[model samples]
Target chain A: MERTYVITGAASGIGKATKELLEARGARVIGADIAGSDVNVDLTTLQGRQTLVSEVERLSDGRIDAVLAVAGLSSPTVATAAVNYFGAVATLEGLRPLLAKSDSPRAVAVTSMASLMPHDDALLDAFLDGNEEAALARAAELAAGSPEQGNLIYGSSKQALSRWVRRQAPTADWAGANIPVNAVAPGVVLTPMTASLTGTEEARTQLAGMVPMPLNGFFGPESVAQLLAWLSSEENGHLCGQVIFIDGGSDAVIRGDSTW
Target chain B: MERTYVITGAASGIGKATKELLEARGARVIGADIAGSDVNVDLTTLQGRQTLVSEVERLSDGRIDAVLAVAGLSSPTVATAAVNYFGAVATLEGLRPLLAKSDSPRAVAVTSMASLMPHDDALLDAFLDGNEEAALARAAELAAGSPEQGNLIYGSSKQALSRWVRRQAPTADWAGANIPVNAVAPGVVLTPMTASLTGTEEARTQLAGMVPMPLNGFFGPESVAQLLAWLSSEENGHLCGQVIFIDGGSDAVIRGDSTW
Candidate 1:
């Protein structure tokens, strides 16, 4: 039987790569994004999220084999927190019923190595608390203030999102219901998101210094997409709530053995 | 010259214990809480935090030697996130200027072993995002919905606060300006906060089973107070952004050497 999967942020970057890979495997893909996708949804607002869910339900005939929440923002802004944290969560939770209809349901979300970076406590708290408007509002204020502030919001949003995945995975609706939920925390993947930074030697050198990728240079989107695809597969039954960092040893270097 | 210190959540629990210990050492102490203290302030609100700061500044005569943000909530509530994460943060950040005036300054916030427990992602993000209203609102909704939901909110709040302390400890205003900021995460301690849970034998047995305390049973507030005193001492200059878990080896047991 061909599986049906919903891949958000499917227009480009990791989402696009994952969508193509899954489609090649003979799966029916329902791609959702801001543009150039089978399902167009903003994912940054409550209405957008509701639309995405309704559309996915309509397209899949109320049955979804898997969901890959790969849509995200690399820059700091209120919208970053809204789309990356809330948007990803809304996609996963809102479509959970559709996923439950499948024999083997799997959900994968894209976090980042940035989750380990310093974060704004306020922004983190807002996201954790589930106040989308307030979290976005705070993120907007910080983005307008300083670059570091923006970075903090982005990092915290990812961290909180990863934590959410872990917390929800063990619950009845997920692991109990046989739905494997997990997140992929990639290091510096070379995608359109990082084009500006990796476009020049000066920027690349600076970025390289910031993240210690002992294994090799930055990763391509395909490498991360492959891991994500596997995680969203039927074989990924045993893994639940794990945030697998494919960051070329950056997480190991930074966190060491602290959170292991 | 007598050193002056400010302690929030001083009315009861860890804050009270710490206040008693500090006064015994001959430090002039200013206690703050909702009632029965030198300053009456509700830490769950911005205005309350401002009042606490202004009052501390006024009472300390413009110089504060140390600060202990020990007030916290063990139960799950929106107020838990507000008081645990925001209250502690506001107490520390709001009083930094006064701490900067001292020759040697130290700040300590009380996190909890519950931080390692499963948490709500939305609550954690809201706290980190620094949106108190949203975090509180979400927390309220969760508390009203489920008992476990409340526990999650409480745990995630402390976790986010601990993360914040670690992130802020090395900044210019902290390590650079000679003020050390850190947090102490205690496991199960016998205090007013845990009275209901630890008071009964059945509750004690259930609690013991939940947390693995390899060293012993529950800890007294004084054991935590001792660690807090050391962290807030003038002799302690090098420690920064560390959330030292003084929880009878529970942290070590749960996390193992993975995050060492």
Candidate 2:
């Protein structure tokens, strides 16, 4: 049977690649992003999240097989936390009822390998605690306090989002409903969001030092697109609450063997 | 060709189940344990690790296909750290050369869902630092100190071992050499090691409260064995430095999502 999927951040980057891959495989894809997609709405607000939920529900006729919460931000600011953590979580939770209608429902989000980097505890705690207000406040404080703290916003937001995945995947609404929710933490890809990191020779060398992708170095979105396709595919069973890293070997090089 | 595997702790529990599962599938398995296996050798000591490596090398003509470092202990003592961390690392590292000779080489070990539990930092640090003596001493101290600290022994040891897999898989010796190293973190397997936790209703209830395996609740060894087999099998190509959890949703229940 043909499957239908709702993919956020589908305008470009990994999301676009995965959307195209799924479409090529004869699946229906409803793209959602800030602009130039089926559902164009900012994900950093309650209204936008509600709009996405209602629109996706209408387009898919209230039966969505999978939801790829691929919308994310690399900015070192509070907005990153809003869109990455709260935005992603809202999209998943909202579309979950639609997902539960499918025989093989799966939810996967995009988290960055930057999640392995050092982050702010206070901001991370707020995110895990599910306090959007406090988390945003703390993110702003960190952004305004120190440059290093500002740099930590992206990592902390993604880490908190990952933790949310682990926390909610097994709950009654998800696992009890037979929905498999997971995440894919990719290393630096040559996405426009990461242009600064890979555009210059000096930037590439510095990135190599941090992520150390020994397998194939920095890769394109197509490499990660396949992994996401597999995770959402019906063939994947028994892998619950995992954040599979689709990096060349960034997780390995960074000593991310199994730190939980 | 019938793939050959060297599985430690093959006399009982998940290891034995995995050994049997592979053999039933027409795969050749060389079981290793303290007693009652093809190669009887203790895995808690450096000498034992070396002995097992040499015997497997000789038995398999120094061209072993895969090594499953399944030998582990749940005891809140220094030996748990010694066997679970140092011994396991030595076994994989020692057997890497033999594995490299195979057409498709793989390495996997047993971590636990307990890796998500709170643990001793100094002990974990010592293990990651690769200082066997210091790690053991710290483990001993924790074991002798508060009972709370003692409880962290097993978790800390397993966490360190997971870290080691992540740390080495991306390096020149593992992924760079065309070999994939990973781990499986199971939760509350009904093995002899966990008899105390699953033997009675009261114990089972307590265990559930702690680990919370909501999906099919307290699964048997065979469930995890298949996952280990896949990790060591030739089919797994892109997954490196991962500690895939086969714990029936315990990882998700414990909020252990995407943690580095």
Candidate 3:
């Protein structure tokens, strides 16, 4: 039986590539994006994600099998949380009903290597004290300051998200529910996002020099798409809640080169 | 050349015990808390922490060598962000100026094993996409209407903080800057915060059986504090932005016992 898949951010980058790959493998693919007509929706807003989820659910014909949430924005410091954090959550929550209905469901979200920034105890203590509203309120305070505040807000968000995924493994039986929730933490992928950064000679050179990759090259969206295909497949049941790295060992490369 | 240290949440539990241990070792210790004259301050509030930082700076007599941020709240699932995340950040940020004045400086924060809980990719991607505020805002949304919502908020905050510490390692130079930042991630310690969980007969029995201890049954704040002391010592310059687990082999035990 052919499976049904709902892929977000599918107009371009990893989502576009994954949509093609899944379709080639005989999967019924429903592609959604902020910029495309496959299913016009904004992932960042609650209403936008609801529309996307509703479309996916309607298109699935009652047989949705997986969700690949590849929709996200990348920035050096700011504007990341709006689309990456809230948009992704809204996507997941919106798709919950469809996921619960499926026997072998799976979900994959995109994370980054930048999630490894450092902070002091006092900062962390305050963050852990609030709920969504309080958390948002605090986030406003963090966002209100200049980006030069000497803290990587984007990295902190990813770290928190990665840890949350790790914790969710035992309770929410993604496997039992026939759902696998996994993430891909890519490092230096050459997407439209990276194109902008790489356009600058200084940024490109600096980033390339940091990686010990065979060609000193970055991974393309298709590489991450390939990983997504495997993770979303039924054969990959054992790898639930895993944060698969698709950045050609950039993590190791950076670690080896950087001295504390 | 005796050094004076300030410990927050120092009136009870790990904070109090750690204070006793440090003072016993002849380190000049000034106890601070939400309600104490030496330095009564609530780390969760920005103003409260600012006041505490000013007092600590003034009282140190020009020698506030290190701070052990043992002060925190551990409700099963309440505003961990306020007390744990933001409070820790504010406290450290406040202390940074004081630490800069000292010749050799160190700081350590206490964390929990709960932060190890697994999370999914979608969540991580959401967190990685935005600024800190955006990610935290999305985290609040993810945690809004679930029984495990508290866990989501608290664990996410700690994980965020932990990740921040790791990233800071490469850039933060304790030897060069004259200050060190590290953390202690203890597993199942006998602190007042954990007393409710471990105090009950059923809970105690279950926890005792679960302890795969190599040393004693269940390590307390004292054992963890001893390690904290070492990490905070000037001799331990190399160790920075690390979370050392003092669980009586619980991690090893879990590994050995797991069949899945």
lDDT of 1 by residue, B123-240 (tens): 8888878888888888988899878877788888888888787666655667668676767788788898899988989999999877755444576787677667766876454445
Tell me how far the alpha carbon of residue A73 in candidate 1 is from the true structure, in angstroms, after superposition: 1.1
Query: Which one is best on lDDT?
Result: 2
DockQ, structure candidate 1:
0.02
lDDT (tens digit, per residue) of candidate 2 on A54-133: 99999999999999999998877888999999999999999999998999998998887888889888998899888999
- Lowest-lDDT window of 10 residues in candidate 2 chain A? A251-260
Q: Measured against the native two-chain assembly using Cα atoms, what DockQ does each of the candidate structures obtain, in the order listed?
A: 0.02, 0.29, 0.01
Candidate 2 residue-wise lDDT, B1-260, digit = tens:
88999999999999999999999988999999999999998888878888998899889987889999999888888888888888888889999999989988889989988888898889888988999889988988998998899989999888888878878888889888878788888878889999987889998898899987655567678877877776787655556788877666887766655443
Question: Which one is best on DockQ?
Answer: 2
Chain A TM-scores, candidates in order: 0.98, 0.97, 0.83
Candidate 1 lDDT over A198-223, as tens digits, reads 99999989988887665445767877
Task: Assess candidate 2 and give its lDDT.
Answer: 0.85
State the TM-score for model 3. Answer: 0.48
lDDT of 3 by residue, A1-260 (tens): 78888888899888888899899979988888887748988765667877887787777865577888788776533345555656665676578678777656777777666654453233233333313444444455666766633245555555545444443432334433545566777767778877876778898877666542322246577767776776677644333344544444344335531211
Second chain TM-score for model 2: 0.97
lDDT of 3: 0.62
Model 3 misplaced regions, further than 4 Å: A76-79, A118-144, A149-151, A173-176, A209-216, A254-260, B1-260
